[model samples]
Target: MSSERAAVSALFLLNGLLVGGWSPRIPALMERLGIAESRAGLLVLCLGLGSITVMPLFGAMTARAGSRSAVWLAAWLTAPSLLWISLAPGFWSVAAAVFLFGGTMGGMDVAMNANAVAVERSRARAIMSSCHGFWSLGGVIGAGLGGIVLELAGELGQGLAVTAVFAAGLVWAGPRLLRDPPAPDQPRAPLRLPRSPLPFLLGIVALASMIPEGAILDWAAVYLQKEMGAPLSVAGWGFAGCAATMAVLRFAGDGLRNRFGAVRTMRISALTAMSGLAVAGFAPSAGVAIAGFALAGIGIANLMPIALSAAGNLPGMAAGVGLSVVTMMGYSGILLAPAAIGWLAESFSLGAIYLGLALLLLVPLAMSRLAAAADFGSDTAP
Candidate 1:
């Protein structure tokens, strides 16, 4: 519980809050603009693009510049991106801003993970899950506030502006908040590429894990509205149900991880996700599908945090690079190829998409165990 760890954890929470706060407003924004569902999806893709662009580059940026500068810059950058989304004049413009926004988010993630690992190493205990739990708290606040703010004027743009104001506050405080420099007790380790077959296998697993999340975030409403024929007002219940489950599970994740260990927690979580996906995908009624998503959310809530903690533990590279690579791969699923999932839904069925993602989780479940075997000394995975 060093000040450095506290600062980074706060930053992590801020990022989650920002996402939850802004993301739910997307449909509102689209409606305000009078755009089609498919087009709105494309615009939302821009945030992914921004994130994807930064993921691959985080390692080098952290290595050359150090955490204080890179991370603070990233935090400041993120707040403004919400404004861009708020003011987007056209689909492409929003897409570009989102791409840049995603990049900042990616960089922030890498630096935060790296810093978290360093703190864990310093403290010599398990804390990553607790830190992540804070992120869950942030999401709860973000989603709640985002919902409230957007409801005020029932205006998406104003919500964006308010979010931007929050971003500005983060920017102002960032310098004072960031660790002055990331100085590991161990001087710079040589950059060993995570060629471990484990990383490659794990990357795919990360992608698969996110597919369900992407679906929850992007497609659930549509599925309820178009497929289940639920009323427009009720459509959002699909995401709300899923997110609520995720938020609750994530808040409790630290307790679970400490009690069961990352490996056991992950294994159980995977099973939950698989079962939830199947139930939701094939449900006969909208209520049933909502229940299924809740199950899926509970299952998935802890998986990503566990996997990310594993990446931080990999011995070869600095935690920053390891996190960057894995994070980049995971976000790639959302940023680059998810639109294709939309295409797939168009041709196939939404049920097909969930099933495909569920099947994909098995790969990660296997890798999660492998990663567990390789994990060093329950030494509090960063």
Candidate 2:
């Protein structure tokens, strides 16, 4: 169990670091290509599109191959894709690279969570939140490192160089991950699409939770720099701070979920995220706004993990299939976030965009009860 846990944890950490490596450098990418917020969003959207395209297929493949083979294959592809993002010279080139990056990420995301789900069930306890906590910790470190690189050599040089190192590390660590628990030694039917609305309901919860979180990851620094007039070095702190808070909360989330149940846990989280986004939008200074982001981080921390856990445990659905569906939807929110926020920014202030996102939190707040109310463990066949 300990070895398996460590392997999954490593994958989570690598995924977070590879992805987080890009967040703090968004402004640099924009400046280098001389693109507007909206255009940058279109490029980012390609990444999301690629993920959406690949996730369901990857999920199906995970069902057939199990997670161990899927994890190694995805990790190999993801590492090079990160390096691709670092070195791309033009807008189209960057966009193309990121599309591949997102595709590989989709595969990794589903496999790792499916692996975690298997581990959790085998152990007969709660560990999903803590597993996600490692991802947040990696995010915090990666964002901080990117900020430092940005301050020194800017995006194309130091940022790319450092990220390449992290990507290489992921390749090295890929083989250490544990295999998915074995299937029953009996022939089974091939994988199929999940027909249950419960997964969709959980996916909606995931999608809503991801919107604010995605906005923070992609746009927080730009907000700090453009709206709040902060320097690049300091701009990344909002996300770093948010990731830090998320790491802490996620580390503690399992206990809270067990004690209070998913419904109450999600309710509190949504409200907290709402309050934080509202405060950040209205904040008077960069520091205050970062505080709000941190607050929002605490609010948004455990949502995806809880949603994925619920989906994986749904009785008849293949764990990978259910997790991939929710992940694809959740990542769609991430894919949409930049463009939506950018378009809204054109019509309104970034502050207004964030405030609007706060209101959007209500959907998840209302729907969170479905996870608790539904019988996730029913014996329905897939």
Candidate 3:
């Protein structure tokens, strides 16, 4: 069980490393392809579309093949997809590469989460949040070092470096992943969407929790630089602080959930996140704003993990199917909402956007009772 948990955590970390490593390279990729920002946004939309389109298919695949096979296949495919991005020659080629990247990454995400659920069930306790914490930690390392690598090694070199790391990591961790048996009675369908209200409501909660996180990832630095008059170096700290705090809290969250119960924990988390957004929106200085972002991170850290655990445990639903639905909905906020938020920021102010997201947190807070589904077996309180 411990080995399985560690392996799953490594998978989550590798997934996050790819995403974080890609973040700092976007500008350079755009320049290389001579694509404008508007077109780049459209290209990014392709990535999101690819992920959303394939999620259900991956879910079905996991159900039929077992998550272990799915995880290995997706992880192997991801390295080449990333390499393709570095080799892309034009806007269209880059868009295609990005789409493939998203699809493979999204597939692995579903497979890994499904496996995580299996691991948690085996232990009769909670490990989901700690797995996610490793992911957060990976993102911080990848993003923090990506710029340096890009400058020193160039795009291709950086791509090769990440690919090498993925390969090495897979060699170590892939064999250790929990072998989830394929559902004996699962239909051989190509896709299966969630048909119940419970999964739908849980998806909504995940979506609400993710939007503010997306906003912070995409705009926190700009807000700090423009609105709070921070230097460029310091401006970067907004997301950095948030990611760091999120990583820490995520590591701590499983214990918190075990102690407080999922429903109460989620309610408190929603309120804390709301408060963090309010603080960031109204903060008068960059330092204060970074602190607010960190606070928001603390609140946002465990939300998706808890929601996903609930989704995976839904009665009469296959773990892969339930997870795919919730992840598809939750990821839309991260992958698809940047453009809409940009438009809103242009129309109003980024501060207003933050506060608006703060208000949006109310939806998750109100619906937090749904998270009680995550508390199963030993997770139940006395």
Against the hidden reference, what TM-scores do the models get?
A: 0.85, 0.93, 0.91
lDDT-wise, the better of 2 and 3 is 3
lDDT of 2 at 111: 82
Question: Which segments of model 3 are wrong by more than 4 Å?
Answer: 27-38, 187-190, 221-236, 283-286, 377-382
Pairs that collide in candidate 2 are none
Q: How much lDDT does candidate 1 score?
A: 0.67
Point to the candidate with the largest lDDT: 3
lDDT of 2 by residue, 209-293 (tens): 9989889888898899999999888888888888889999998988888778877888899999999999999999999999999
Best by TM-score: 2
Global lDDT of each candidate: 0.67, 0.80, 0.81
Residue-by-residue lDDT tens digits, candidate 3, 259-361:
9999998999899999999999988889889899889989999899999999988888888888988998988777677547655655677788898899998
Error of 1 at 33 (Å): 4.4
**Candidate achieving higher lDDT, 1 or 2:** 2
RMSD of each: 3.5, 2.9, 2.7
Query: Between candidates 2 and 3, which one is better according to TM-score?
Result: 2
Model 2 residue 272 CA deviation (Å) reads 0.7
Q: Candidates sorted by TM-score, descending order?
A: 2, 3, 1
